[model samples]
Target: MLDTDAWWRDAVIYQVYPRSFADSDGDGMGDLPGITGRLQHLQELGIDAVWLSPFYPSPQHDAGYDVADYRGVDPRFGELGDADKLIAEAHGRGIKVIVDLVPNHTSSEHAWFQAALAAGPGSPERERYIFRSSGEEPPNSWKSVFGGSAWERLPDGDWYLHLFDVSQPDLNWDNPEVRAEFLDVLRFWLDRGVDGFRVDVAHGLVKEANLTDWTTTSTILGGLDPAGPPPPMWDQEGVHEIYRSWRRVLDEYPGGRILVAEAWVAPASRLARYVRPDEMHQAFNFPYLDAPWRPAELRAVIDETLEANDAVGATTTWVLSNHDVVRHASRLGFPVGTPRMPGIGAEDPQPDAALGLRRARAATLLMLGLPGSAYLYQGEELGLPEHTTMPDEFREDPAWERSGHAERGRDGCRVPLPWEADAPSYGFGPTDASWLPQPATWAEYALDRQQGVPGSTWELYRTALSLRREHGLGHGSVVWQEDAFAFRNGDVLVLTNFGSEAVKLPPGARLLVSSEPLDGDGRVPTDVTVWATL
Candidate 1:
């Protein structure tokens, strides 16, 4: 059930990538009607809310991130009326809805962008975006997150900055027009009864003055640098003032509306600023997600996470996997220190599936037992792994092309979900075709096949979520145990065995649930996590 008072503080939100979630029209793609029909499945899964990825009208250059309209839904997904119905239906079921807001950039096809291009260099239309005069060499040394130079030169010899794909033009947040437009956009969705927004590129809305050159030779992933003076393009102090204004707008509405930042900032303290009392409500705990699967490393990240959030009077948010990264079910199987890749292809080294699933289950229990909110990618509960062998011909991710085919990109994790064991398209839609082809082995992981099966990942999640709410685990404070790998939250103790040997539990402890069954010796085995009362 949704908590009426500050529900987002400890809510478990499920992210739905609209195109691959479920297709109701048999058009080979998922849509609003399709998602409306599948609400029952999420309700059964026990999630407090759903965070739908962008469905705004666009050319699909970046899979709907390049929004052309802030107030209307894409015709392919559904009309504005359909979105209204969805919000009402979801609210009736005691579930909140959060929609993605892409404020950093807009599609080149957006009316504002087209006018900017037609208005030439110095017009008011062009001021809404970053446009500068340049020679043949281009204006700056900034690199695109997708690939190539960050600047795109037009026929008029002027260039516009696009930190991502060329079809997505970065808005000049320095301009009053751009800032005021987004404020209106925020109120537009909140008026439609959305619970909140997942702000895309939340750390990138503001850039340093003068647009200086960045010459660091560091390898960056998802706009994150390990350690150094960060690039001027991200996490600027001006971004905070923007969010503070946004906070005021959110406070105007009742029912505790929230704003979640998808910021990838560094040093736990820097991330905490995004969640300050007057800023955002929550920022994703990426350090926890990026930490290697080891006891020492995991413990350190947890401590850091808790301390950082506590200082700012904000609840911490935990996430294992999302649309832009490899699913944890496959990622945890790789050796520690392996650089996280966008996606794996058939030629890539395959992960140990059995080992990955075991660790993933254990990780979920540990994360759910923590004192804060958590997010689950759509199919992670089903133990879904990446479609590691997708052919290059079927790739749709812009990164694949932008990187000149060196990276396989994230299409593998965005494949449609399997709902039935024997149904066409695994019951993802009425038609046999899915946006991206599904793996032939997907049937075994179908929801119908794992429904009531003991030891199945689906059943494990159902049981864990039920217990989480029942025991107030999300609201509990952690007390570290004698073993660094174990912690007690209220009356429940959660321990994870990261070593190769089995660990014996203390005497008189009553086991409540475990990721895997105990060994014959009644000890916790390697890569296993258990919750018990002592």
Candidate 2:
């Protein structure tokens, strides 16, 4: 068992995108029961905890990020009883649970949002949301992260802010009601036995007090310059206060419940602020995720992350891929310095699959050998690549329609998991249909095909995780080796070769595992990573 007090500090958390993880009722969508049925898969995979993406009542405008109710389970995902059962089952297997919480905005169908619309211009309900009255133009020049204008106008000559989609409206955090409501919402889940929360848009809750106009015409995804002045809409000073309050609430519970910030703020130093002693326990290390696959770039990010988190008295949290971004498996296939895209299309330049898989495996080994917590995106263990060839007509991500078809959006990476290669729907459910169609090539990556196969990605992950736990590598500090590309965690030395030629190992070092097989000379080949005993 993990140390109960600080399990999150070094825990391996698995992210389950509920809609695409597993389907229980053959409704063509994954649900709570589906996740519960698959807990053993995670247990066998050796993950310390499970962090499920939002499954609350939502319109799914942003794939469940547009929450309609904070305290209830959506009927499509299953009833509240299913959630309770899932939590109980997870805890029974010694696995913790972290649910996603969307506090920055709510679905327009939410009771509060609906009431605000009905209550008109100056009602208390309207005060709960960011409603502004301006002639014809929007309150400001801010653009939605999804696309287009950030404001939606009503017949009453009033407009409301929506940083994402029109179906999701931003809430006025300055309002006391909003604060109190979220506090109660936290208690509701805590009372139901959730171990923690992964806060969505954690840095965006408190925007600039005046709702100031952004002089530049850029979307939230474009991001603020880390070296430049802060943007008015994100990473505001007020956000820290909100998290401080949340930290207190989390402290009130037993078993060390944690709060993870999904803050996309830049420069490692600025990102560290969210994880201060009294604020969030951990924040996603996005700079590391966005780093190029080269050894120097990876080492630089690792050093910055450790240093920054050290200054804040927090353990670093590392993640390679999530629901919002492209899968690293496909991303690493391209050359270094390639810009990140929402999704790849049939017409786009395709990745080198063999090279991508080799690097992705090497990266995962290096990530596991690091001295901090790690988050694994679902299907990554099976070496799943984005369904880059998915037909445009079936695309459903809000970014697709919102961007006027210019951007393909994130649907490619959200394809359903494959369990049994020969079963219907690849054993994702009892039926043969899924919300997003899996590629025909996916059969080769199914769990059944790789479960016990030597050198398979699934087996590689299982072996690495087992070794990581046995060696206490996650709790060890990193000791840099003479080679800038290598570091030692405890007695295990990890080295990655990014050059075109092979690299020789020390004479006395004994090899534990290699992301790829060594050459005839027993040298690490290009794009390969190896872990050995000192």
Candidate 3:
């Protein structure tokens, strides 16, 4: 009999950024009840699971990623009961729940950090975190991922490592207490009925002892060279041991509780190490996400990813956009080979909305047709474009200040979702004011506007997801075609045209779906995807 618990392997998981998902109480910020109220939307959208971003007690310094308390939800989101309810309610609809676990660092306001600050350097309390004496310079020249220096100085003539914003202090995993604490944190959520965890900075929990600086820019968090020598700060051999222990903890629970790593390692082989049968179940396919729309590049990434995961007997996960980067809709709208940046701004070349939406829809079909799991960021179903024109004054991403306002940060992609047209907050809530401003153009793509509309992006996503299950295409091998981005998933074949001209469709197969209307001659147009039953 097939095991039912391993739902994660090919699950089409939807990612929810809590503060922007929904605003139940009209506080202008999304909360737990808001997510609960909107669970039906996900159920109807045909996802297998929902991976929520961090909503733990926090200073909101990094938008809840800098968790202050691992065991409790922030009051702004709801209490512990709401979390329990969200889990139970989601499971009721046959959707599994995976919450974010930020083990890499904690908010400086955390009890341990607060106690360490009061205990000063060298004390046992201070040992819980990375602390060094100020001797005319920082411990090293490691820069913070957000910007500036990775080390922050305190009033007591000692410095602590942040890696991110100063408000987030990196925990010293070498300490036994730290490891034991995270084990307990895992149990705490597992006990709460969470099916799994999306570990934040999974490659960073353990650092090299010497704290050697690669002098690699840390402006991107563990910005180690993917093709160069392994850096001292990330993807250390020590991280695997940590996961081995975590794997054991997960096994103690039933229902196949899983852990998904957010490791940024590369070359496919190094990434395979994190999911070797005994460790994590899956890791984000950042390499695939970063690949441009070119057919050759996209095909190569898929081949490399499949080969790597095949080595470890693990599943590969494909994600296009997330909270941390520019929306793929806008990103793909740029010139075919342009780089994907942290954020888009008014000064930057604006994306061609019509052209971008076309490519995005095609990308969605292409991603879902792959032979592994897929993740959908909150508003991608509506074909939501990034709010590239957010007012500079309202920008709050740490990157803005860290880069001296030169980078513009990630606020553009994080604007609240529009649910209804001509309604307050576009029906994201009863109020018109959301934490981040919503662009007026979003109304055209609101969920209410797209529901039941034929050929809308939302309908396309729904049809694709439904077809994925009916054909069991998610759990198979691919046979790549040399001429175009074409591959077979079981009895179905997915073909995409990245070339300027039309590509002839394979004969003798039933056409199931196409991203664009078939050309007059019924060929696949540029930037289009089509599925067929072979």
Candidate 4:
């Protein structure tokens, strides 16, 4: 079913947002043992691997993206021993593990950053970061990806650049020290038996050599902008060199270690470069994630993604939701053109819950049927919706402070998950403590309610994932038709009717799975996807 050279070609990778997955102790935080304990859910869900987001020591400014240390686990999550056990436990269940690697920047509290701060301007320590002298002003007119100036002035009157938050100082890739350090970081994890890494800000490790001023007017930025050329700080040519060196580290390890890029590049064609034979193994299909739910938009992205990856002999990866943005379920409910803020609040218009659930289920079937690897964000299989009503006082995302409360930030989507319908903390722990509050409404979607119920959301995931492997759907070849899409891998034929009305099935096609029951007339309804054998 999978490509022989690459184990990830058609694998299903589940993402675990550590802080929200499950809490082990009563301290109200998710930890490594909590994840290890919950391995049964993933094993039952039928994913081939699990991608754990960063659990490294941090100020939590960017939710562990700014790593204070690369070699050890943060005490809040657990010690290094807990992580080693988690990896082994997952492996025992036949699931590979991929950890997040943030190479673009490090937490300001990192020893190197502290040294840079204490050493002041023109010191070799400052050379480890991006320090420039433009006389009290920032080096350039560029903006931070979060908000405000990309540069922060130091006590010495010199400025240092941070493309992300001020607490995250960008590393100097031009410096040999930075490059060697990250290579060792990769080895450190690989030696720990991790299968690979999900490289954060993969395209941002290297900036343009000149550090020129930004020429664009669009302040709103995110993964792979739809309307603009590559920004000055992203998708630079020098990045490929860094990846090439890192790729060597992965190759050194056995068991097919890989590097999955979180690179947000455009045109699909440019993204293909990251997956060339010697670079990273795969890049997130952000273009598809950003696409509207319209049939045309979705179709174009699939075609471009497949074509580009085919050119490089690499696999394409698809994802529906993650920790950083609005959940796909809620996003699909809003009017097609509504602005998608990171977090939702009382001021925002409510989305249609019923419509959102239907579309989200349909989207899942569609994504799983596609040819190549897929990623499932934690809680999507349980049909979780974004917690749009998180109170202002509890908000902790940097975007909240950065946006001056005008934007709600991403706390809603990061809410702790519900596992038991009636238990305190919804069975996220033995007690009712969680880093982020679980909504009262989450009981309706708890895993306890969904488990073992035929035609339930949990069963749907188990069935689809099982069928995907049984029928080799992940490595299929897709064929598009009017108002519908179909694909074949081995004996499976997955078809979807994106049109507004029901449609008759192809002759002799026996149904294997459907997102919703068929109508009395046996027509495939709009916003439904089905698997069949012809």
Candidate 5:
């Protein structure tokens, strides 16, 4: 097994969505220089690394996931030289750099796709992708994650499969050439001194050879369709083989590079396989993120995740929010109105603000104190709440178009960072207009406003991360204190009370961190609390 004590184990990784992180050129979109300028901010937050969302050359159909080139940086983000600078600068600050590697599919405009299309059926290049006979229809009744049929009829009358958007055609992992080409892409970045990669949709690399029809056994999100009936190709058996091959390639690198997979599945037991020593170093655990804010549900998810992953010798990771979903602050019913609740309460509720802050702190402590790596989405440390005001005209997410108005897509959470409140674009850029407007509420939530404020969301994150590093919290065996509803890391114990009442700790326990500080003895009876051995 690869060493579980690598730098990334239990490390806090801050994600940067390039298009909205910072804009250095006043072009209204964030770029590499903007990111380079903010390295100190990350360092101050105690993050060990930064996982930049894809900045590769792409048609932007799916906002850069549909990569057209693996080696080149998108001009909007920066040039190849800028990427090298980012790596060097980040390394100098003791912060590892992990770039997004979208290997599951490539943009239809990718050179390989173009070549395959030009070569016609039966050509060697055609095998690099899933191409079927022109006369036949789609092999199965599978739907894309975005919507509609997963199969698209190409101009040549053949069907090309895409699990996501049509612009992103899934690569045929059955083809050795496809495997070799992607491995080369991995090497290309490693050669450039990248610390590691967050493999996008890593589990979807391989699909079942049979391409059988999905079995509608249960209902999916929105109640529109039933799930459980295996989609034509999700969680295919062949995926493990591909992961093993990728692991071999990663092992060859000298840095002992890390690979974190984005795998979300049920039976919890099956999820652990992605992080087996032979596969990835870590895979995201979405159980807590997806579960309702209830004590029993939360407890069960934690218990099941630990139990399921017991045999895997790799670190576990947790995230509450990312670019693709609604912010946790909103999901937990923190005064944020959804379609279900409109104009539902008093204009200003102190309890709402306090609850939101407490929950945010509790979630951070819970994630950081877990026995694995933790991921922090951009702006999450600042406790930036979601803003879903983007008009249809301004929306760039493909999910927006695909889901009609049923879903807001991810544009709200992906909006520009609020760096400076007074700046025209919240310090994202000096431009009068950004690709997406910064939320007006940024005046209060901007980074500058909360940098050192005690009890502030950002400060809580800084404190939690620093404490984890100082006490070596995530490196030891995790013993869950069932009665206290906490996870113990060595002598340090993280206690969380999802309920509103103050949870009484054992008399001898010392307060290490609390979302709400008690007036005396440095203890607060808040939603969440952490205690360490005195």
Candidate 6:
């Protein structure tokens, strides 16, 4: 068993989108019992912790993010007792549980929001959430993440702020009552034996007090042909105050709980602030994930993130894919030159299949060898490729409607896990039909298929995680290489050949793990390689 004290610092956290992970009942949805049943599979993959997305009681408008209650488990996922069993079972297997904390907003149907609406401006509950007068417009013209005005008109003709879906109303972090309520929520889970949290939309806790329109003329979301004014409240400076308070609350726990922030922004320096000791344990560094599949670009992002964040004395975290994004294989030139596979296209063809596996293993090594914690989306360890053809009718993500179908949406990556290759429903459910169809080609990529294969991506993940546990790879300070993509500390050098062709390692460097096989002395004569330790 890995040590629980610093488990998260170097840990490989497997993200389980609870609704899609596994379903015990024939409900065509995943639940706690299903996850509890699958604990041994997670143990086999060597993941130190499991980061379950929000399973709190919600109306299901924003999938569990629109939390109606913070302390209770969603009946759809399971009862409160089921959650306790899952926690205990996970801990029994030496796996820590870090649940997603959506403290930034709550469902519109939540009792707090309902009370605020009923009481209007005069009630003390009015301070629990952001509510503006009918005469006053939203503080600014900030756009909601789901594509409409960030402010919603209430029944009383006033406006309430919602940064994402209209169903998700933003809480008033500046209000002491709001902060105390969330602290109580934190203690609720901590008392239940949850190990830590991956704070959702962490930077949105506080907005600009001036309520001024955005003025920064930068274009990072899309093109900047005629750069538009920046949204007034994307990354306001005041959010840190609340974060420091939350950090203190976490410290009050016995185990010194972990806190990871979902801070997605350009310019690594700006993202680094969230990771300072007083704020968060680490913030997601998405620059590398957003970069093109080019050696120089990847190298530059790695160097800049490490260097800039080093100033703040906090580690960086990396993720390639999650529920919100497309799968990595398709994103990074896999099955090159093909428009995404049709929903009914042939399964990863033979030779191409092996190539895809190799590339995934290489990328996994890159993430693991990086400076901080690494996040693995649910099926990534099995090298699961994206489901290219999610029909419109079956699409559950709000991104589909919000993006006007311009983007394919995140349903591809959020497909249910393929637990049993020959099972009627690929083991996602007892019935053959699931909420989302299991990819027809999942047989070859199922966990059952790859578990014991010596060079499978599954084995590679096991090896990488084991190396991290045995060596202090995630704990050490990173020393960047001048020209290449390498980080070293003392005698240990972790190098990656992001190129397609082979590259020679610095003299005396030994290959600990390589995308391809190495010679007897542990060297990769050709490209797309990584070397660790000595």
lDDT of 2 by residue, 1-534 (tens): 233249888899999999999999998899999999999999999999999999989988788989999988999899999999999999999999999999999999999999998989989999988999998999889888888999999998889999899999999999999999999999999999999999998989988988887866554354457877687888999988888999899999998899999988888888899988888887888888888887778888999989998887788999888887788889888887897777998888888888788889999999999988999999999998888899998898998999898889999989999999999999999999899988999889999999889999999999999999989888888888885478889999899988888999887889999998999989999888899996
Ten residues in sequence with the least summed lDDT for candidate 1: 217-226
lDDT of each: 0.89, 0.90, 0.89, 0.86, 0.77, 0.74
Q: Is candidate 4 or candidate 5 better by lDDT?
A: 4
The residue-by-residue lDDT of candidate 1 on 1-534, one tens digit each, is 233247888899999999999999888899999999999988888999999999999999999999998889999899999999999999999899999999999999999999998999789999999999978987779988888888999998889999989999999999999989999999999999999999999999998888889855222245466477778889999999999999999999998888999988888888999988888888989888888898888888899889988887788899999999889989988886676877899999998888888999999989988989999999998999989999999999888998898889889999999999899999999989799999998999999999889989998898888888888887888899995489999889999998889999888889988999999989999999999989
Which ranges of candidate 6 are over 4 A from the true structure?
1-5, 120-123, 134-140, 215-231, 334-357, 477-493, 504-510, 518-527, 532-534
TM-scores of the candidates are 0.98, 0.98, 0.98, 0.97, 0.92, 0.88
Q: What stretches of model 5 exceed 4 Å from their correct place?
A: 134-136, 215-229, 334-354, 519-526
Q: Which pairs of residues clash in candidate 4, taking residues 3 or more apart in a chain or in different chains? A: none
Candidate 1's displacement at residue 237, Å, is 0.4
lDDT (Cα, tens digit) per residue for candidate 6, span 1-534: 223246566677899999888989979889999999999988977888899998989998778889999899888899999999999999999999999999889998899988888888757887887777756466556667666677887667678888788888888878988888888888889999998889887766787676676533321122112134434455667878878887888888876587888865556777788877677887877776676555677778878988977788766687887887667755554544443321222233322445555556677776777756888899888788777655667776665566565444567777888877888678888887677777678887777787787877777878878876667667766677776767774445766665554556777666676766765665453335575555
- lDDT per residue for candidate 3 within 378-480, as digits (tens), equals 9999999899988898898989998888788989888888998989999988987799989879899899999999999999999999999998877877988
The global Cα lDDT (0 to 1) of model 2 is: 0.90
User: Could you tally the backbone clashes for each prediction?
Assistant: 0, 0, 1, 0, 4, 4
lDDT of 5 by residue, 1-534 (tens): 457668877788899999989899998888999899989999899999999999999989988999999999999999999999999999999999999999889999999999989998788888998888746678677777776778888777788888888999999999999988988988899899998889887657778787777744311122111245545455677888887887898888887787888765666778788888788787788766776666677779877877777777667677888887767665555533332211111222222444655677677777788777788999988887666455557777776566554445677778888888788887888775588766667778889889878988888888888888888877866787766677678888777775555666767887777666764644446566665664
Candidate 4 lDDT, 1-534, residue by residue in tens = 223557788899999999999899968889899999999999999999999999998888888988999999999999999999999999999999999999889998999999988888889998999889999677889887667888898778988888888999999999999998988888888999999999998888888889878855323336656476667788889999999998888888888888999977887889999999899898999878878878778888999999999889888899889888789889988877566666788678878877788888889998998889999999999989888777788888887887677778788888888999999899998898888878889998999999998887888999999999888777677776443576565677777777778988888989999998888988999888888888
lDDT of 5 at 100: 96
| Model 5 whole-model lDDT (C-alpha atoms) | 0.77
